[model samples]
Target: MFFSKKKNKWILAAVVIILLLVIAYTGEKRERLTFPEEIVMYLVAPAQDLFTSLGQNIQTFFASISQYREIKEENERLRQKVSRVQEEMVDMEEIRQENRRFRDMLDFKEKQEMELLAAGVVARDPTRWFDTLTLNRGYRHGVEVEMAVITHRGVVGMVSSVSANSSQVLLVTNPRLRISAMSQDSRDPVLGFVEGRTDQREHLRVKMDHMPPEAEIKPGDVIVTSNIGTIFPGGIYVGEVREVDVDMFGLVKYATIEPSVNFNRLEEVFIVTSPVQEEPRQEEHSADGEDVPEES
Candidate 1:
């Protein structure tokens, strides 16, 4: 076994010496590579080319992945930016609509006979839903109890209670409120008292009671305050006649009226002040002893 190991070592040394001699001889040559060297180079060339190409392909793939990630991040950022812009547009549109409504109200006030005091609705009577809403104005602003409150569409209510800074309005949609209503048509000559209906919720409607049997009430007929109306001003729009009903005796008739004012969407109102009739008052004071100003 020892002699065999010694023989293997000598064979390895001989191979190393032969490789050294071949390298030295090749280094001195200026001519083309020898046939053996050419064959060796040919065998390794394809592997070297494959390794260089694989490195280039790997670098390209990594670069493409990084670029795609950047694009995805940029797209997400753009989507968020668009969403914010749409939200802002919606808010601006809402503001624009509010301004338009206010403008229409201003125009309506200009057409009124009495001085109109514009006010915003601030609260509602919890027990009655939209039957009663509170206004930002009160006695201090010349808003008196029983004064008619109106909107651009039509009459809304009467000021039922008053405070220094706020007042409550009894909406016409309330069951308690009754107004003498008349048909706008000169031919029909329909007259009745209007009262609010509570059973329905979709639309604010009123009952026109004690309609005359001969009265020819019809749908789409515009109703207005009659001359008999004491609280509300005459000719103020009330509602449109919807359905007509007759009693079993055929002596009395009633009709349903769709109110012109949309109480559900009430946001603002104008209080109608009566014309000053009495001799100029000496001083203005509320029943509660708070000094107030006279209507201008």
Candidate 2:
């Protein structure tokens, strides 16, 4: 407290130098703790171990998340593959069914007695005004006017016109096409003619006219072509009887029939190319007027 300025400055400088030396000494020996500090570290060792284990668990959790993402992506790809395989299987089954149907058609063609030319339905007439269809066969393939067209199931139509390689068929639903029909049951009359109704609103309906009022055609009777038909062959199936109606005078009767052929789904048919066989005519005569009954 009594020192001069020069002595005071010397004492401040000495104090600063001593403070620097103390800081240096502490920094150097900080790593080598005293006995009490070592005892404190030993007491906290388990907590440090716990912290290390927790950090390792966090790292493992992040690694698991990355693996799970990869697995999910792989599963999605597998599902897509399964979906494609299922689609292909469905397509294959359809192809198999088509092949079986065609095979059955070939067998039916062989069993037929008449010579037939298998033809495909090329195009359907877009004009709704007429019941007509185009066939792949034409004049070049022996398809001619009035040639009966039929499939394995039943009658379809007749060739109405022809080109060099294609032909048009007048379906049974046409108002002009009429075929003489007969009933399968002997009880029903042996004579009838199938003609399209005047309404012709639907292709599924037809009328079996020229039947006697006493004829026993029933709702389930099967009608077929008669032996007298000039256009269609005898014994060819026409349709099934749906209902019967008598005339106002009860002199004649007509029946509504459902055609056996599904014209809407017609795809392939055969044209009858064989010669027509006519039934033999029978004649009877009573010569001499049978007045020979005088018996001489």
Candidate 3:
């Protein structure tokens, strides 16, 4: 085995020496052969083609990666642009809605004959438990305390407090609010007091008292201001009768009224600048059968 290993090493050395001698001979022959340049080019053409193909593949791989990165970056930029556009569209839509609301309020004011002061609802009480709203108009705008506030649809509230530029209104749905109202269809008026009840959740409900037991009242009867109070104007819409009750007491009947305006969704209102007068009083008959005219 040792002799065989030594023999193998000698053979490897001989092969190396032979390869070196062959290389020297080939180099000398190449210098003397003087082959045509075209022929040499032809001989090396396949090798050049193989190297070129490898280089092109490497370049194509790098180019494809760069193109992919560019596409990703562009896609990201487009997505951000689309998101910004969508947000702007939402803002524009909100502005359009607000403009429509203001226009509707202006139209309502124009249709009325009474002196109206337009005011925006600035804020709702932080404690929503109380049905009170703050308005942008106040004493500066001729919004006096106890002045009635209303929307185009119907009555909203009465002014309770005022500042130069702001005022608090007591909503009709408040438990403490009371107003004398009557049915529009019938001339006989009834006294009703508005109250906020949990059962009537979103509307101002009135428990009408002093309605004559013989009075004809229905569910669909329209209720309006009787002008019995000094605050609200006569003929101003108050509410519609929803339910009625007649107890054993033969003289009086009560009713539940659903206000014409939805207080929960109130936004803007008109304040009555001038005082509303009650119905004109008739002359009284004295005990001596003489007619007495009351001073206006």
Candidate 4:
């Protein structure tokens, strides 16, 4: 067994010496590889190529992940910027509309015979929004109870209650409020008292009651306040007659009126602090054929 081991060691030394001699001879000038070198290269080349390809694939995967994260962040930033721009646009439009409304009110205030105090609607009765509104002005601002509330278009309501800094208005759509009104027609003027409909709590409508039996009131006839009321100013627009009906006893006639003011969209109004006596002028049309409130 010892001799066998010795023989194997000598054979290994001999093979090493022969490999060194072959490398020294071919290192400078070699046309082709030896058979043993060719066999070794053939076995190692495929494994080397596989490892290199795997390294390149890992680098490419990491690069794609980084690029995707950057793209996602950029999109989120752009979305926020767009949202901010849209909000700014809406704010600008709202300011423009408010300025226009103020200009119209100023024009009306310049032409009025009564003392007009501008007030903003601050609150609304949630349970009776159509019936009542609260204003920012009160007795401190010359706003008093029973003072008529109006808009550029026409009459709105009456100040029902007052406080130090705020006041409540009883809208014309409320059943408890009443206004003495008359037809605007000069040739066939009819007299009646206008009051809100009891059954129309959800709707904004008023009825002119106590019409004469021979009253020829019809639709499209404009209604205005009469001098009979001590609270409401005379000649102020109330509404237009929508339809007429006979009483159950047929002894009197009544008419439904569509108010000139849109209560739902009321934001600002003028409170009549003091009014002077004036004759009701006939309703007129503008050059554009639009019905305009005749200035008193």
Q: Write the per-residue lDDT of candidate 3 for residues 1-296, one digit (tens) a residue.
A: 64379888898889999999868865674544445656887899999999999999999999989799898999999999999999999999988887787787788888777788989888887565677999999788888887888887778877878999999987777655566567787666554544445454544575555577877788888887765556677677878888888868666787788888876667778998876765653232222454322111
Q: Number of backbone collisions per candidate, in order? A: 0, 0, 0, 0
Q: Specify the poorest-scoring 10-residue window by lDDT in model 1.
A: 278-287
How well is each residue in 1-296 modelled by candidate 2, as lDDT tens digits? 53468888888889999999877765684658778757988999899999999989998898878788887898899899999889989988978876776786788778878888889889877664567889998899888777888877777777878999999987777656666678887664557667666674645688887788888888889988776544566677778889989879888898888998887777788888885565531121112232110000
Q: What's the best-to-worst order under TM-score?
A: 4, 1, 2, 3
Q: Which ranges in model 2 have alpha carbons more than 4 Å from their true place?
A: 1-94, 200-202, 280-296
lDDT of 4: 0.81
C-alpha RMSD by candidate, in order? 10.8, 14.6, 12.5, 10.8
In candidate 1, position 87 carries an lDDT of: 94
lDDT agreement with native, every candidate: 0.77, 0.74, 0.73, 0.81
Q: Looking at candidate 4, what is the lDDT of residue 199?
A: 78
Q: Mark the regions of model 4 whose C-alpha exceeds 4 Å error after superposition.
A: 1-67, 276-296
Off by over 4 Å in 3: 1-71, 126-128, 186-195, 198-204, 247-251, 278-296
What TM-score would candidate 1 get against the native?
Answer: 0.67
The Cα error of candidate 2 at residue 153, in Å, is 1.1
Residue pairs in clash, model 4: none
lDDT of 1: 0.77
- The estimated TM-scores of all candidates read 0.67, 0.65, 0.63, 0.68
State residue 74's C-alpha deviation in candidate 2, in Å: 6.2
